[model samples]
Target: MTAVPLSDDIALRIGLAARILPEIGVARLLRVLDSALGLPPTADTLERLRLRDLRQGADGALADLEPERLKDALAILRGEVGDTQPPPLPEPYVEGELPGSIRVACASDSGEQLDGHFGAARRFLVYQVSTAEIRLIEVREIDDGRAEDDRNSYRAGLIADCQLLYVASIGGPAAAKVVKVDVHPIRLGAGGEIREHLRALQDVLAGHAPPWLAKVMRQGVAPAGGAA
Candidate 1:
């Protein structure tokens, strides 16, 4: 089947909805939308879609989903929901300032929580972590406007500087892309507070740097001083 082109706004909406319903892949969900709302589903048509519409078209993909899940997914598609506002970022640091620290990127939909899929996350909360401390240094928003064919590559590129990535879930292909960029991806199946995860990382850093982590620490360049 020929793919339908979607406007940036509509594409972003679909991405957010996919995050909510990870059980359904984006391609399959798009097929469901096409089936339910006709070819080339738009924000307007999706806003008008009712639960019955999805049930009739999902072809069992969404059959086991709870009503609440359906509602949330629909709300996201309609732009009724918004991305979470991240907490205030800590002061920036120089590249080599945090000695023995590894840069980590956390996929997040909710502010300060690692509750997002690698492909569909709204933003990446980046942290500079060392055994001594963890600092939030940057928040990179995903560009859902990119072409669908290379969207995962684009997202992975955004955090290419980070040494590690944390997400609630990530597909095999997406994980491969992340690995290609030299960023190790970690899946936290049940997401939790960003600080908690970072603290655990600190524990690992303070104790024994695993062979893999020790390598990452060595890969980091020393800071040139001054805020970055």
Candidate 2:
């Protein structure tokens, strides 16, 4: 998308923000800009404006949005709900510890595959993936008895302790919601066995890990200098 150029200061701030918030793809950035600043929704809009315009527009637009909508928008801009880190994860595979455990949740109809959407799914099969092995943690039942203002975020909260959420599909807002809670969402084209996903995650942990995962790991990793 050909977005109008921003001034140097704005560009620098955006670049730095994008470094930490990888989910803010160019498409999303443009969409947020249009939504927040009243620019044309399409990326090819010819409106020339500076970052200050975007900032002002976002601040004003945010005031009118509902809380959940505001969260999604802020997530787009800052990369997280409030930039607060999750509790420290345990080491890669601490035998009985939860500190660095990489817990994952998968939405499924049969409780066996990634077969459900975040909004419609009634349950999630949880797993703990470590460098050496993957184990079934538990079956997380979604509380849909009552209606929620933001179904996506509500579902994400169901597996708040998890680091990743796998589903057959997810919308952009749902994805953002999970990302806000420090749970990276993964979508599958079709349903697959829960074990298969765990195996794949195990393989990734054994290897060098991707950029997103590397960052996730670093978030859990403790600083050597902090040791007494």
Per-prediction TM-score: 0.66, 0.53
The residue ranges of model 1 lying beyond 4 angstroms of the native Cα positions read 1-84, 221-228
Candidate 1 RMSD computed on C-alpha atoms after optimal superposition onto the true structure: 7.9
- Taken over the whole model, the C-alpha lDDT of each candidate is 0.77, 0.56
Give lDDT: candidate 2, residue 92: 41
lDDT of 1 at 116: 72
Q: lDDT score of model 2?
A: 0.56
Reference-based lDDT, residue 202, model 1? 93
CA error at residue 182 for candidate 1, angstroms: 0.3
Worst 10-residue lDDT window for candidate 1 reads 219-228
Clashes of each: 2, 4
